[model samples]
Target: MTTPLPQKSFHDVRQALLARQEIALVDVREEDPFAQAHPLFAANFSAGRIEIEAWNRIPRRDTAIVVLDNGEGLAEPAARTLQNLGYTDVALLAGGLQGWIDAGGEIFKDVNVPSKAFGELVESQRHTPSLSAEEVKALIDQKADVVVLDARRFDEYQTMSIPTGISVPGAELVLRAQALAPNPQTRIIVNCAGRTRSIIGTQSLVNAGIPNPVSALRNGTIGWKLAGQVLDHGAERQGRALTEKTSADAARQARAVADRAGVQRAQPADLAAFQAEAGRTTYRFDVRTAEEFSAGHLPGFLNTPGGQLVQETDVSAPVRGARIVLADTDGDGGVRANMTASWLAQMGWDVWVLDGSPAADWSETGQPAAAVPPPEGHTEWISPAQLSTWLQGDTAAETVVLDMTTSVNYVKRHIPGAWYISRTDLADALAKVPKAQRYVLTCGSSLLARYAVADVARLTGAEVFVLKGGTAAWITEKLPLEHGETHLASPRTDRYRRPYEGTDSPREAMQGYLDWEFGLVDQLGRDGTHGFRVI
Candidate 1:
């Protein structure tokens, strides 16, 4: 029999949150189930992803971590994994997610609750101005002096957008708004796929004191669609470039906003000090476009576009009480990092903007690869061509392919006849697969699959092989790929489908999502653990 892991009561975790002590309230289930219900601050770190994600996200092995699941049996394996990963302080929530409910903790739904809730709270306190979707549409129809700025990512803008909107993702809004709308009389409209980014983006310009009038398109694209407006598909309007003068002026305004929001400015020495702190978890992020970061950036800083970083804080920095240090290559000053830090500070983070020019040796370029722990034992790997030949062989009937990629990716495409399996739950998933003489493991890069090879070999006592390049390499080899969920060994709990994502969400669900956002402020108040304060 297994000894139960040490546990923390709901009060214990809540106290850590309220006291602003370093604690990670982690839910080990996949996002789909986690989003259905969890404490307001619970960060989802699915059991299977701990090895790849925990080090970068939590950063400090000694930080208190309380893992929970709604009786899904994922927490125990995850806690053990954390311990194996050299995490010194790992524990379980006393009664799982149920304990929080039993203790009268306020449960919240959907992902990025902290950031989304903060957006709602900001609007509630600041009363950030907004115009109805219909009102904005009339302005566009009249060819009025207005430029709609989509606060979503560029790809999202391309998927669908307002007829004449420009892609100026959240963090870029302040830095580029002036150049995009030079005339002081132009009405600036900000929008996103949903309310949070729209509210935050518009409020950013307002707080930065942009001269032109600005307002969020109320409820964003969902509202636009509900109002019977036709969204343009495949729109590709980018935010206009800024001249030196405009960039410098924007930097000055951004600094002022950061100052007003109490964001601390940090130099390299200060950042070095932050890195040397043994007991604290500090995330160093370069808040710039990934391409810019790839060209060159300060060492030890991860690339997280400022907009997405703010939108998905729970994922980017799951250690709720950890310190965050943001760096940017904005000219004259760290405009992007400053603007991002201002919002983070208001969201109750101890954040700093690393300012000034990066030295020549800030020459470290490219994104850091996930440092996946290697497999305990090795398995033979076959090239895509070899696998293709084997699949066409007479004994192919006895060979089973296990695809360990995300369910969504698996649904979209996979190796022909591959059985989808949640690697963390492989033992049980194996029962659903046919008895076979050979088993193969493959994922996106085969990096994740490589780790699973040893586990599969141990479980099935069969000849297990890993695809050398994963599914990506197979596709690159011009092999035929299969689509759809042909065989699922485990449930598709890897991701949560947001009502605001994609263009095909049901109208009822869209309205329901909007209604959910409306109540977030009250929920935040009741929870009383968030340290958010809008300036």
Candidate 2:
């Protein structure tokens, strides 16, 4: 038998790390757990991503690596996997992460890595004056000079954010901060689900060289809920402040920003004219958070969060030459939209921002008014009655029914014979979906189902249909609903759990898997390999 690799003690690893030795401390934990607590130097490497993403994460083979897991028996195998990948100096931590902590060694909290740390810093400094739910309600009553920045992801902000807080994700802080307050003296605050992001985000600006004092919304909205503060929903946040700048003023500012960035400003009439123009690929993007986008955005506008749009323009708008129009709410929304427009212009795209703020009422603007059409080439519209008929008809042997709802709903109940596809996994699933068969898309609501139908149709050119009113409607009608398998990926076989979904597998396993997958993709790109596509 081959000789077993030697293990290193916590003291040995600590000494090595403190000496500034070239080392990569990999915490084999799930992101959520890892986020809560981790070694200051530890980077996450889930087993699920090992094959695909790990290599790219740990590029230097010479750097000594110490892998850790929570009392779970993953540390040894994970180290071995690294060794197999040609990492010459890999070892397992003595007793995994807990062992390190138990050894009376110092553990670091809030060790936000580069990009995410940078995002947190932005939230800390620029996205400031966030109010707790109760505080915000009080502010509304008091009419204070404070502006609440919903530092959570846009979708979350849209779904249920403090009514006063405008959606501005953590990453967009640097670019949009200046426009958000305009007046440097205006108190700015940042908030998230809990204290971590809000606290760290507020601190980031303090760390940055920005000339502003910032603070976090204490405990975020959760604290507000605990305090029994009520949250406003739907059209409550849409009402415009009568005393604030008029829509015309906001439009003029938007036009000026667009002009400065060398982007065209599309007035309502111009948009109508552009829509009428033939053969031009025009993509309307509501560059807001998902929640806001979902909470009644322009018909036909795709929800591409501003920060994501800036970072992943190629994926968001694959058509390089297409005209892109972005919309956001007033203040923070305009800031993000204008910032993205600036970047698109720099990249040689014909970009534009909608002339005015995204108010509740856009009906007065003579812009092209039309419902968001189903994805191009999607000819089939299945009614509730037609679904049974369609299900009965033999379409293909491998027809996949993908439910893109929240994991909780998927776990509670889903369409019979449907494979659950969480939103996070949509892109990956879309890529792997067989081209030969039709795809059926459903969600908690009809809107998401319709969107997925359009998306899959666009990406795969697959014959797709949306389940009208979605699973909620189906459940209400007392239609059949199948309970999804408790474990989608076998823990024994796959070695990792799906991160976003609930799974029996350890968090370290999932992180390792993702790290491996990312590494593989990087290697493939470096080797000039192609044809195998990621959704």
Candidate 3:
């Protein structure tokens, strides 16, 4: 028999981790068990995903790796596979997690790995308190004294959010919280889907020792959905309304706090002059509601909204020490924008806000004319004669077809051999597309196809062409259309089930979620009247 592999002691692994050694901890349990609980920072490289997403997800081949499973079922095989893939340092976690646990090591729980641990910290500190869906509805019914602050990314909030919640992302909480909740008596609640930032945000206020009692909207919009609550999706300006406790009052308090914090705002001309200055990197943001933003706003402006801009500034603008300019449509936007600017100033960024309305609305005052309506949809029908000619000619090896329509539509039907990539995943997908390829973009509607062309041109600087009227026009004109799965693979359909939250069966995930909510309700009861309840 071959000699047994060297086994590392628990202390050795822990020491290696503390010293920041090049180590990849792999939990080899089935996806469900692994997802429920594992060592913090452990990457999931299941047998299936390893073959497909491994190269993309984990690019380093020289990093040391340690694999573990419930017993030893998958550890050896996974280690061998990584070794075969040119991983220089790969080994099995001797005794696996059981040995670590037996040695009294810690294990973390929750969905989405690292985010859950962060959320747990927020929850433990009471950093975020949230109302259940029922509680929000009841509050609405009772006309209670509370303000709802949505802490999700801007796009997600615009797509769907609690009816009354005003968008104020986590990073901006310290700056904008006072504006959303002025008095110590007026309650403030933060929300995000399934905790994380909502909890972290609520806690941030508490940690800063704000006078008001702040809580998280527990479980966020997802919990709201599971609670059988109705979400307001039709475009409406619910954020414009002010309760008896308003953001205006909060703004006054925030301005006072800003004075104490030594924060400043910039006038429109000052901002314009700054933009004109050379060798300076600046990101201008319009922090208005999506509807107001899409209707008409500044040129070359991204509609981040107040809440999400605060939460995802790092992803939105990764460069440090860059100047930031914010624009708001009304009191809500203005207060939130100023609040975010204040924080960035404290964080060593040169931040400013426009003194007046966004540029798109300045047309009435003889500013550049109002934004022109985007062009109507087009249908570029390639004649049958033209198609024959192109087919006869040599096909470019560096050609790619991007289908930017909805996933559901792509599944139902699409052009033959076209790569299906949703708009949401465009930024990431573009990075993987070979620069050598001449991309041809298409979508269900010609409008989206044109938008894809523009995006490709802006992002890649590569030659791109649209399919004229998109796949719809192609089919309508009796042109050939391809069907069935093409280059795309199906997403993982295996659902995770939690026994602690409910049963081990897949059907019990929802029930388990409900059970967790009930537990939260009980905890809230003992914790006193933070003004939240579960339905």
What number of backbone clashes does candidate 3 have, counting pairs of residues 3 or more apart or in separate chains?
A: 10
Over the stretch 282-316, how does candidate 1's per-residue lDDT look in tens digits?
99998888788999988788999999999999989
What is the TM-score of each predicted model, taking all chains together? 0.98, 0.45, 0.47
How does residue 191 of candidate 3 score in lDDT? 76
Give one digit per residue, the lDDT tens place, for model 2 in 1-535.
Answer: 9668767887886676444344567765545556555654466665423433344344345457778877656667667766776777777888777787787654543323222332333343345454555755676678776666665565556655655777667545544444566566776777665444565445434433245556677656555555566554431232123223433344444445456658777776777777777545567787765656666677656677765665445335533245788877665437557656755565456788887644654323223223332333443555555565555578535466677665556777986666665332346556654454677777776554664555566677767877777777778877677775642311122122233222133445444433432343333333221112110
Indicate the residue-level lDDT of 144 in model 2: 71
Candidate 2 RMSD to the real structure = 15.2
**Clashes within 3 Å, all models in order:** 0, 50, 10
Model 2 Cα displacement at 492 (Å)? 14
* Candidate 3 clashes between residue pairs 3 or more apart in a chain or in different chains: 127-202, 127-203, 129-215, 129-216, 130-216, 130-217, 130-218, 169-307, 380-468, 380-469
Off by over 4 Å in 2: 29-40, 106-133, 203-214, 232-535
Q: Which stretches of candidate 3 lie over 4 Å from their true place?
A: 1-150, 153-188, 196-213, 219-237, 243-247, 257-262, 294-296, 329-333, 343-348, 356-361, 364-409, 412-466, 469-535
For model 3, residues 214-255, the per-residue Cα lDDT tens digits are: 777776666676777766553233233354344555455445
- lDDT, candidate 3, at 5: 52
Quick one: best lDDT, which candidate? 1
